[model samples]
Target: MRHAGPKLLTQIAAVHFVSHVHIMLIPALLPVLPGLLGVGFIELGVALAVFNIISALVQAPLGYAVDHYGARRVLKAGLLLGSLSFLLLAASPGYALLLVTMALAGLANGVYHPADYALLAKGIEPGRLGRSFSLHTFAGFLGSAVTPAIFLGIAAVLGTRAALAAGAVFGAAALLLISIPGSGVYRVAEVGNKGCAGPVPATGRVRLFTPMIGVLTVLFILLNLSTSAIEKFSVAALVQGQGLTLTWANTGLTAFLLCSAAGVLCGGALADRTRRHGLVAAMAFALAAALTALVALGVLWDWALVGVLGAIGLLTGIIAPSRDMLVKAAAPPGAEGKTFGLVSTGFNIGGAIGPVVFGWLLDRGLPSGVFVASVVFMVLTVGLTLAQEVFMARKGRGALRYQR
Candidate 1:
């Protein structure tokens, strides 16, 4: 089992990496896609929006499928479907086809969180689960970080179609790796009650809609909303609001992203050492909120802005593992798929909303509002985290009393 643990983690993490790469592929090649498809940028944007909307809508139902059908099987099918979507795009490039392929990819994209978390919950040992989850998240961040440079470079040298084909190949390679005979992927549906930390109700279906899960869903939304603001608009905020040059603004954003990735590894270790995952998340969010507020003040020097953004990134990244751990704790034994799926939808929701809100702020000549709004989301997330901890504690005590 010990030997199998790392192998399983590696395979699943690779698939997650591929998923992120696929998610970013079209966006990375946006410069050339509009020309190739003979469509305006608006159409391409709509395609991207279609991808996100479909992913958000389908994720919860797909989670149920992951629990009913085996996770490994569902995950493999997702990989195949995602890969084929890109392959078909590469083979037949047109405006309508692009939309169709992106929608297909979106449905395929919805499978990752539910299927991936379900497999990890069932396959990994409890002792190292936090680290496993962190590594998985780090892999995704790495993929998203690198996709633009790698795929754009491919497009520059070869063509946009070639880049799409390369992405398909990447997914296919991940699929093949996990589908191997001794890959250690979980082969059975996880319907047993062994994985739940607290007393599970008789009707497992109710677990997906519990108040704790509702809190988690909201937490996920606020978390993503905060981070998405930083990721999408911080550079603009620094440039426009603080009068920093574009180069320096971009430099600060890069620092934030890189430090956030490093923080995830550190966070995994911290999550393993303590069971107070909610407290860890709350503290991280609090510090992050404070830093973001300072950034919003627009009083820092350019170098100081970079440093502050880096600190914010590290603090926010530190929250990821603990955040996932909290969700894992809240999930009922066999309902990890639906629970994670339901919560993960919040990411898409937050992702969709953050850009529009921040973009509006920027359009209104309120660049500082980007950081200010992010701070607001972060503080709300801190409160939500503490509230969730209280709820979980009360629920645990009630379960203990019932057992006694």
Candidate 2:
């Protein structure tokens, strides 16, 4: 059992790493794609939009599928589907074809969260689950971090098509890794689903729609909204509002992202040590909110700004393992897929809405508003986290009294 946990974690993390690589492929190659497809930026933008919309629409339903059909089966299908989409793109480089391929890719993208989380929940030992989740997340972040440089370098030397072909190969390799005998994926799934009969009952389905899940969904949305502001707009804000050089602003953003990844690892250790995930998340967000507000003030030295952003990144990253732990704690048994799926949809929702709002502020020359808005979202998240803790505590007490 102990050996099985680490093996499963390693394989699942590799799968997650490839999943993120696929997600970033389009954005990474955007510069060359317009010219390659003989299309303008608007056409490309529409393709990207199509991808996000399809992903958002299907995520919840897919979560149910993961729970019903088994995570292993659904995940394999997603891997194959996503790989084929990219291979198709490499084969046919036309605007119309791009839209079709991206839509396919989007549906494939929706498969990762529910399937990955479901697998981890069932496979890893309880004591090690927090660290497993963090490592999995860290792998994805590493994928995104490396994609731009690796793919662009490939595109530069071998052309766009070859770069995409490389991604397809990566995905195919991941598929084989999971499918092979002795991978332990099959063993984990069998153990996890033991004693489960046909389909999930209506009662089980109802559990997914509870207020706890809804609040967690909102919490996920706020988390994404807060981070997106800093990630998508902070560099612009710092350069324009804080009078920093473009180089310095980008440097700060890099620090934030790198530290955020480092923080996830540290946060994993913290998560394993404590059950007060909500307190951890709430405190981290509260402190992060304060630091973000400081950035909005635009009064710090350039180096100071970089340091503050790095600090905020560490705080944000620290909350992530705890955030996943909170969701896991709230999830009803046998419903991990649906719960994770439903809450993860919040990422798409926030991703879709956040840019318009922050871009609007930037368009209107309210650069500082970007940081200010992030602060607002972080504060809201803290409130939500605390409220959830209260609710869960009350529910626990009620159950104890009923038992008595």
Candidate 3:
């Protein structure tokens, strides 16, 4: 087989990029939901929980399909499912259908990531891995970054229903494009596609590195939960608890995501040099970042405060690619998706647990608990990282997750 080509990368990246655009529409809509639907925070929480819980449970099975059945089939099906699910959201005459649609959309959302990343891992040359992953991630972030503006514009010009309908149209277009003959990962993997080059002859010895895989999964889980905790509660804490305005609250949140984008770019470029050590550096940054977040809550953060929050976001992106590389290297044969699914499952668990606990603390009137919880989670993850490094060293890494 020949090497992978740029066209396929762009195609995969395009699908990934637009898919995020679809997801981000939900968050911006959250603020408007109460006025639009007469629902309160409890109902909104239920909506989000239902969507994510369904996603968490179904990821492993869908990922397993991506591993054995091929990404083409899974990707195409997910696209269709995703597009149709929005119609469910649009057609919902009641909360039950909304729940169903959101959960289905979540399931469809779960299908894309592991399959897409695993496909990239299999097809791309090793030297280009960091760039490929980073570009793909950046594409998604770029889509998300534009979401607020898009939502603001749509809500202003077309009204909520029409704007969302336009989004569904976008999803539908993606579904159609993904289904086109030789258009998606499946066809790219097909022989004679010229772009995807199908399966590479190279495969990593992953089973021997189970310990690394397990630890990495744990870290990803902790990281996702830690992030969700801050994102979910930080705004509410600032606005309601701390009495800051919504706009100011949002500025801090946006800073975090934007900085994360910067971190990923830097992390990707540095991977070839530091390899595993890049992750250690990222974790160290996260330690400092969590501390900063705690401090910011106690003090007043202004424009300069955005810089610190941005640094926190930067740590997430910088740390992520290294962890992804570890999982890619450690994935067992015919189990890339399942491996990712397991890791994603951990994310879901964190996603689920974090908000409830954080909200609980908030309801209890311990505004500091949210930041404290984030600190504790980060601390635990760092401890896990250090323990794994020490264990690997003493055992001579008796695992091959990283090279000497």
TM-score of 3: 0.85
TM-score against truth, every candidate: 0.94, 0.95, 0.85
Q: Pick the candidate with the highest lDDT.
A: 1
Off by over 4 Å in 1: 1-3, 186-206, 398-404
- Residue by residue across 1-404, what tens digits does model 2's lDDT show? 32357778888899999988998999899999988999888888788888888888888888888877788888999999999999998987788988998899999999999899988887788898889889988999889889999999999999999998889999999999999887767666432254643444442445568888899999999999999999889888888887899999998999999999999999999999998899999999999999999999987777888899999999999988999998888777767777888889998899888989998998999999999999999999999999988888888899999999
Write down the lDDT of every candidate, Cα atoms only. Answer: 0.88, 0.88, 0.69
lDDT of 3 by residue, 1-404 (tens): 33355655776777787778767776767776566667787887788788789888888777767766667668767777877776666655346766776787888888877777767776677787776777777778777888768876886787766556666777777666656565434434532123444463222333523666678768777877667766667787766666667887789888887887777777777664555653454465566556556544666656655566676777767766666666676677656776876676777778888877888988998876777777777777777767765765666655554564
Clash pairs of candidate 1? none
Q: Arrange candidates by lDDT, highest first: which order?
A: 1, 2, 3
Query: Residue-wise lDDT of candidate 1 within 1-404, one digit each (tens)?
Result: 22358888999899999999999999899999987889888888889999999999999999988777767878999999999999999999998989899899999999999999988887888889899999999999999999999999999999999999999999999999988885667442255334534443343445478788888899999999999999988888888888899998999899999999989999999999998899999999899999889989988877898899999999999989998998898888778888899999999998778878999999999999999999999999999889878877888899999999
Q: Judging by lDDT, tell me the better candidate of 2 and 3.
A: 2
> Which 10 successive residues of model 2 have the least lDDT summed?
190-199
TM-score of predicted structure 2: 0.95
